[model samples]
Target chain A: MSKTILIVGGGLAGTIVANGICRQMGAELRSGALNITMLGTSETHMYQPGLLYIPFGRMREAELFRDQRKVLDKRVNFFVDPAKAIDVEKNQVTTEAGRTFKYDYMVLATGSRIMPQTIPGMKEGGHWFYDLDGARKLRTALNEFKGGKIVINVNAPHKCPVAPLEVAFMLHDYLKAKGLWDKAELTYTYPIGRLHALEPVAHWAKPEFEKLGIKYETFFNTESVDPQAKTIKSMEGSELPYDLLITIPPHQGAQVIDDSGLGKGGWVPTNTKTLHREGSANVFVVGDTTNIPISKAGSTAHFEADVTIDNLVSLCQENTFAREYDGKVFCFVETGLGSGTYVWFNYTTPPNPGPPSQMIHWFKLAYNRLYWLSARGLL
Target chain B: MAERQKIDARGAFCPGPLMELIAALKLASIGDEVDVWSSDKGSASDIPAWCAKVGHSVVEASEHDGYWSVVVRKAK
Candidate 1:
């Protein structure tokens, strides 16, 4: 009998794992020795890195979306439904639509969700560039701005650790292009003590931030935002006034993981090296859903997929996972004006970012195209 | 000189130039050439790579004045 492997979440990690496994186990899949099914909430897959280009008008919204069906391989079964709960004891999952799936093995790649409402007045008062709608709104607001204090504030545990810095750098270029650089005061505030979570990246970015005249405020735990007053207060009672506010809101794992009691603090706990869920033998987790103590960026998902697929193949064959994930992460940080930097690191090595250059920027752009091919297991 | 269509994708980011070349190739007749002018450094190599994958032919790829111009012909 064929063993069923059900994957939850069809985002970058889920799709990549599905396609990777299908390609590697083609004969098994064709011979009905292995069965695969992917469950997702929607048919649309958004190329999230394109969200970074929206504020700069470098990419259009239409270019960022593709049919998820087109991206997944034909050998993998896909369902458009949200997973509701996981019964780890029974090796089964239930969906919101009352459908239940039994599996021999399961993979969770549900990613993360942004909670803007967690902060007072944030939804109405501030804008973000992480989502398509927010980016479009910010683009319009940025285009219509005359000149004043522009603040980029970040809440903790957000996705894409370098996004706030990228926004700051791009905003500087945007203002300079409009001849309003001197008229606008750019400030970036983070809950962390350093400008970046990664020390090496912070070191390289400090001088660049100085050159762009962007003020960095660290240890800024957000207390609340007074949208009417156009000011944000830190937990320490300090206040910063702003004419425009762009916020990276708090992020949490999917509610299903929490509801199923598979997660604590809204995140699934998995072995950093083994990529297996804590206390679950046949369950594996990847992407932002797992509390992996790394930047919750797409590159992290891409790298984790490699380890997960390798281990999953071993599990299907030998009833044991054989591979260990190194926690390798690669990120392309856009510094604006057709230039960017590359950050590469793993569990053992800290990030050693190279100087910003146009070539890295182009590589990042090329990645957007290659990502689709990658989703189809073609690249 | 053979008739060639020019796509000025200069200053556009990666995949943008490649997408433009693909779109132009769709409109061109077999054997007609499309030239893409891109300031993005990746275009010089990416366009050729894409052409090779999809059965198109890259005729001439050259650099000039802060940008790259790549000429591709629709093979089929």
Candidate 2:
């Protein structure tokens, strides 16, 4: 009998694993083997990078999206319902719509969620571009805007490590195009000392901000936002008033993960190299849900997918897990005035910081096309 | 009726050469050609494909020293 594989989350990491499994299964199925099931809540798959473009008027929300269900290959059974609980001991998953599926091996690809309106007054005043709904909300707010202090703050550990910077630079471009450049005071605030966790990137990014005349406020860990008064206060008592508050809220893994006792707080604790869930040999994690100390971005997801699939194949064949995932994160930071930068880090407990390059920007711009082609199984 | 701008994008990766070419095209004259030198294995085929799709003209492309120089004329 063929072993069953149940995958949760049809996002970047999940999709890659499913497609790879199908390719492997194709060869196996010819010899007769392999059963796979994939579950997701929505049919639409979003191009997350485009959310930064939406606020800047560079790309439309409609153009930056695709049907997720159609995107997946037909070999794996796709379900358009969210996975609510995973009975790890029994190897079954309960969906939000009240259906259960069993499997021999399970993979968690459930991505992270932004806590925006969860903060008081955010729904009433603060704006964001984290999700499709958040992007839409921010768009409506931008359309009616004049000009004042524009504050973009990071809540920290969010998906797409470079996103906060991308949004900030795009906003700079948007305002300059509208002739509101001088009228606007753009401030980018982060809890960390640098623009990004990677010190070299922070070193490079700080100078660019100086050239752009945009203010960079570091070490201001945001406690909360008093949107009614249009003021954002940090834990240090420093406050910045904004006409438009573009905030990136705190992110955590899926709630279902916590409910299943598979996660603590919001993240699934796992071996960074093995991706094996703590104490469970048959379960693995890929993407933002892992408690790996790296940027939870799509590239990382793609990289992790490669590792997870390899390990899964090894276990199935009763082979020792040989490949260890080195936390490799790549990001494209957009700098306004028609330029961007690329940054990569090879995490080894103490990560080795790679130098920033103009090539990184071109690489990122090119990634859009590469990703499209890659998703189609063309590359 | 002018000399085309030259872009030495040799030894660059997939989209690097392409993006440099696109960025240069924004500054070039209507009839001026922009030459891109790329050593990447993918760029030799990609440049011509991009020109065909976007209505640009490919003047000349040749292999040189672990790289290829693909010249593009801005048609529109």
Candidate 3:
């Protein structure tokens, strides 16, 4: 009997898993003993991390996308139909196109999305760079601005932990280059008491903020944005007036996870080590879809995808797991226009960021191009 | 008999070399040495740390012109 593997979501995690398992399980696939299928929402796969450079005009928009079919292994039975519901007990997934897929083993990689509309009046007032449309709008806004008070507001559970900091640093450099630095007063606001969720990163950023004379307001949870009044109010009783408002909006997992009643807020409760859905031995959860308290960065998804690939192959071939995911995450942090540093940490070790340098920045640029290879599981 | 395998992972960045070493060790026999050559500075320490956590033994580690080579013996 042949074993069927169904993967939901064709993003980073799912793509890597689909490509990787195909690479390792070639004989099984050829002999008609294994089936791998992927369901996605689109034909184009966007490199989301490249969206950061879009607002700054540092990277071309075309450089951030690839044809999804060309990137995946030819053996995968791919579909552009998005998942509507996943019934774990039935071991089945239903798609928005009114089709059903039954699997021997399933992988849920349905990633998260930004929900700026959740914040009252924010969708109308604020500018964000998390998506392509938002980034293009922000580019025009930044390019046309003369200078004034600019507020960089951050919300929790957002992907790419260092992005807010990176944009702030890059914005400062941009203003300086345009001779608008002195005219512009940049203020950063975070809901937490520090600059970042990670303690070491907060400690590192404070001095850099001070050196650059960037003012910050800690504990400023957003209450509402009054576009008419040109002011934003916080739940902590702080009101900030701004000429330009840039925000990192809050995030939520895919709607299908909630519709299926698998877990609250679209995140499935997952076994941190084994990457399995809670109470379901045959179901796996990967990347941002798992309710694992960690950065929702691309590296997190890539690492988890690799683990899932290895385990799924082992289970199909040997009725066992190959290894466990060790909670590993690696991310590169851009400090300025020309310098960067990186952090690598697991469940046990805390990340220690080194001094930013031009070499690491170059490496980041190179990696940006190599992301296609990474998605294909060749890297 | 113990055997030696070499992997040239000189340009791979953080976690890249470590992941490659793990993949190689899985295919090697017990007491086999997998020498990982890495230009990433973090790997000299990271490879050994991973070995320690996963019950593998690092026989020797040394630095060359611009890279480091760490030899590990798969214990399991």
Per-residue alpha-carbon lDDT of candidate 3 for residues A24-87, written as tens digits (9 for 90 to 100): 9999999999999999989999999999999889999999999999999999999999999899
CA RMSD, predictions in order = 20.3, 18.5, 14.0
Q: Residues A107-186, candidate 1, lDDT per residue (tens digit)? A: 99998887788778888888998888899999999988999998899876678878888888888988899899999999
> Of 1 and 3, which scores higher on TM-score?
3
Can you write out model 2's per-residue Cα lDDT over B1-76, one digit (the tens) per residue? Answer: 8557665544322124665565456446788898887656666886787677557899998998887889899887
Where is model 1 more than 4 Å wrong at Cα?
B1-76
- Model 3: per-residue Cα lDDT at residue A248: 90
Q: For residue B61, what is the lDDT in candidate 2?
A: 88
* Model with the higher TM-score, candidate 2 or 3: 3
Query: Least lDDT summed over 10 consecutive residues: which range in candidate 1 chain A?
Result: A190-199
The DockQ figures for the candidates are: 0.01, 0.01, 0.02
lDDT, residue A281, model 3: 95
Question: In candidate 3, which residue ranges exceed 4 Å CA deviation?
Answer: B1-76
TM-score of chain A of each: 0.98, 0.93, 0.99
lDDT of 2 at A193: 44
Put down candidate 2 lDDT per residue, A1-379, tens digits, no spaces. Answer: 7788889998888888887777655765455467778998788877777777666666677776678766777887899988988998888999999999998899999988886655566556678888778888788777777888989887654677677777777777787888888888999987544576455556767887888888978755565688778998875458899889988886768889888888654578777678888788888899888866556788788888888777777666655785988777666777663677666555433233455456665676677657755454444
What is the interface root-mean-square deviation of candidate 3?
A: 16.0
